[model samples]
Target: MTDGAPPRARSARLCTLARCVALAVALAGCAGTGPGTAPRPSPAPRTTSPQELCTRLVTHWAHRLLADADGGYGDYQSMGLSNGQYEILRTVLDAGRAEERINGAVSAKELIGHQIARSCTERYRGGGPTGGPWQ
Candidate 1:
């Protein structure tokens, strides 16, 4: 064995390196938003009209709906919403237009839900009361 302990140490190092490489590949594969899928399209230019702003705010909430944990947009039939409604909500939230429209009147839930359900008029249709308008 000459002056050294042994050759087993080299094999251990090789095994560790292989494990690291395999782990890295597995993680990269799990990341669905990995490279080459195309970056998300830029949001629409800011609007100057008040109505447009309000509508945008509503659209933001609708998109945050929790149809499934996996983030699938639901068909209006079972979910009681149309594709337009789902698209609007997702668009508004993605655009980050709510910070401008919401005020002291909005609650965390209300604001968030409104932002999420902005376009889910059918699923969460009817605006009667939400426990004193977020107060």
Candidate 2:
């Protein structure tokens, strides 16, 4: 009931008032800028270790060379390999080939992986090459 309105009009006014209150509450919630509503900090960037990078490079080139039936070493400079990495690749491939002959292709692939890991770790143990950038 209202002072000058009929019962139906009073109900309509109450409904509109309720709708306004609900809208204001919803907007207030969206406008919040408290600590809990702050944007989350981005995650730290991931970094690859030198040894891991070396292993990846050598392993990728080794697989490429092994897959090519022509048995070409290709241009190491064009392959993005450092001098040291190229040497590592050559050594690993030699062993890989011997392993393939003795065991199987699968054994050779496994040996390549192990050798790359070991070689890269050893190469980077002293904080990578100090001779030059391409070493």
Candidate 3:
């Protein structure tokens, strides 16, 4: 009999050891990119005029709030509005409600168009109140 371990046992141990070493080496080559690694940013949403933004967001939110008798107001953050922007929206919506009552939804929509452009122009006249590219 061989002085060392049996041939099959020795081969099995060597094979397992080799596989473990190969796996370790393979894993070592792959370092996961976690924090501190700047990942490619996703494409940003297409920007439009402040008036356009107001037009889009205000109409949507107005409908939502009006749909519920509770006037379930949504947060500005959810509506993608800043505090200043929301104030403008509130004023616009208030006027729109009056317009709608007197005329109809059509008149209200026209009012929104005019108010959004005027309000946004005023709100953003001072170079949009910030230097960020969001403007």
TM-scores of the models, in the given order?
0.23, 0.71, 0.51
Q: Tens digits of per-residue lDDT for model 1 on 20-61?
A: 999999998767667677656889997444334334444433
The best candidate by lDDT is 2
Report the lDDT tens digits of candidate 2 across residue range 57-134. 999999988877777866889888999999999999999999988998899999999999999998899877757878
C-alpha lDDT of all candidate models, in order:
0.48, 0.90, 0.73
Off by over 4 Å in 1: 1-68, 92-111, 114-135
lDDT per residue for candidate 3 within 3-49, as digits (tens), equals 59988998899899999999999887664555677666889998786
Q: Which stretches of candidate 3 lie over 4 Å from their true place?
A: 1-55, 66-69, 130-135
Better of 1 and 2 by TM-score: 2
Superposition error at 85 for model 2 (Å):
0.5
RMSD, one per candidate, in order = 18.9, 6.4, 8.3
Number of the top TM-score candidate: 2
Q: How accurate is candidate 3 locally (lDDT)?
A: 0.73
Worst 10 residues of 2 by lDDT: 31-40
Q: Going through the candidates in order, what is the number of backbone clashes in each?
A: 13, 0, 0
